[model samples]
Target: MAGGIFVVPLLTLFAGASFPTAVAVSLVSVIACSCASAPQFLSARLVNLRLAAVLELATVAGSVVGVLLVGSIAPGILYGLFAVVLLVSAAQMLRPRRSAQPLGSGWGERLRLASSAPDAGGVDQRYHVGSLPIGLSLMFGAGTLSALLGIGSGVLKIPAMDAALRLPLKVSSATANLMIGVTATGTAAAYLILGKVDLVLAGPVVLGSVLGAVLGARAMVRVNGSVLRVAFVLVLAALAVPMGLTAFGIEIGPLR
Candidate 1:
């Protein structure tokens, strides 16, 4: 979730990589992380394959569009947009969620968009999917952001599934994890065609991210959803300010 948001900035500010190179490397790392973690989520039955496939169509289209736009947009403008996205995600994470209502009659109902998972008590808990259009719209944006900024886009995907589609946090997270590799593959192809990907840098990043993701996926099953939300908020808030400043060409002492 956070890899690209932090890694791109660190690479550019400290490691002296160009923005495009950093972005490409970040996408590579995201793909590695997704590849490592998603299988485990799939084995655990946490990933919603149907939901992921449905949303991926929109995401892929948006990623193509974003990749086309990347060359035309200025790096500073991209950074500013990234900051805005991070801030919005932070606010969304901080917001309290209501108990999701049943999947009332709609496209979701017609599609049989309900799922079940075992709860803490070992009883099957059923949840319904809602707001298909809204979720798809947000997913498109998430895909665009993922391509434009070189992220996994979990920041947007999680909120879209949780808030718009009325999915449980764990399901949303796992599904997002599964979807990211596919999404990044599309963007990475574009980057490779553009000669933006730095294999030297991406090599180490991919290895580290894959290992970290495996550990994180195991930890995720044990953490409370509320704790995850708080951590998401804090991480995004911390990234947003520095990125917003960087966008305006302001360098805080030593970080530049």
Candidate 2:
């Protein structure tokens, strides 16, 4: 969870060597994180194919625009916006949920983008379409931030799905994982064409992340995650502070 929160900001400070370097690292993280989580999600039948597709289309479209804008945008300005985003995400994670309210109508009845899926527990849970316009709008923000910062927008997406759209936590997290890879793929191609990718530098980070994520996911199967949520929230809070400070030019060490 700390890795999820801090990796991008640390890299943004220490890296930014080239647009390609950052994008490459983001891709490695997205691929590794998504792949690691894929099986359990698949086995648990937690993914909503229809909803994922809709968001993917929007995300990929947004990525194109966002990545193109990166060359012209100023880093400090971008990071300032990013810090706000991180702060917002951290706040969401820290907020408590009222699970008792019936999650409301299933996806079919609620929003146009929602879909039903079986949870990790193998119980069929209906999820509503939830604020489709709002969710898509959030995806646009996620895409923009991702392109500017070279980080997966899952941090943004997961929370919106949970709070505004009312998707179960597990489903939102899994779907965010599904979306990250595709979003990265869109920007990565542009970075590659621009001659920004440095495979040598990217190799070790990708390798380490992939292996670690796989191990982490496997362990997730055996562990009880009830308490991990609080830990994850704290991790989010910790990462937000440094990134926010650095973005605003409040100097923080280059710990990347």
Candidate 3:
């Protein structure tokens, strides 16, 4: 999830990779990581398949448009846009979660988005989905950013699901994990066809990211959801600062 934030910068600044190449590698790594983590989430029944599928339609379409625009934008502008996205995501994550309300008759209920899951205490908890339009809009933006910046876009998806769609934090995270691979694959296909992906660099990144994601999935089961949200915000803030600097043509040493 956080891979694209740091990986693109490190690869560009130290490894001398172009923005497009770094983004291509990041998309590949994100796909690998999502693939590694999603099965465990599915087995745990944390993933919301119905919701993921619905949102993916918007995300995939947005990703194709984003990939097409990447070549027209300047690198510095892209960095600035990425930094702004990170900061917005951090702000969203820091906002207090609203209580889930009763499901009203609308797109949410029509799609059967309300569901139950076992909480940490092993009790069933019911959650109602809200604001499908808002969630879909954000998912579209997330997809665009994912392709444009070489990210998994979980930073955007988690907040959209949790804040806008009224999903449980754990559910949002797990569902985001499950959806990221499919989202990245949409953009990765474009990059692959353009020959932007560097197989040598992407190979190691994919392997390491998959291993890390497996470990992260295990840890998610043990960690409190509030703690996970806090950790995510901190990571976004940390990455955002350096990216903000780079957007102004300031150079920081390699993160590695």
Highest lDDT: which candidate? Answer: 3
Tens-place lDDT per residue, model 3, 109-226, is 8999888877878788888788889899989988898889988787678778877798887788888887888888977887798787999999988888888889988886677878
TM-score of each: 0.91, 0.81, 0.90
Candidate 1's C-alpha runs over 4 A off are: 223-232
lDDT of predicted model 3: 0.82
Clashing pairs in 1: none
- Backbone clash tally (model 2): 5
**Residue pairs whose backbone atoms clash in candidate 2:** 107-127, 107-128, 107-129, 111-129, 114-129
Please write out the lDDT profile of model 1 over residues 52-90, one tens digit for every residue.
Answer: 888998788889888888889998998898888788878
TM-score of 1: 0.91
Worst 10 residues of 1 by lDDT: 96-105
Q: Would you list the C-alpha lDDT of every candidate in the order shown?
A: 0.81, 0.66, 0.82
Per-residue error (Å), model 2, residue 190: 1.2
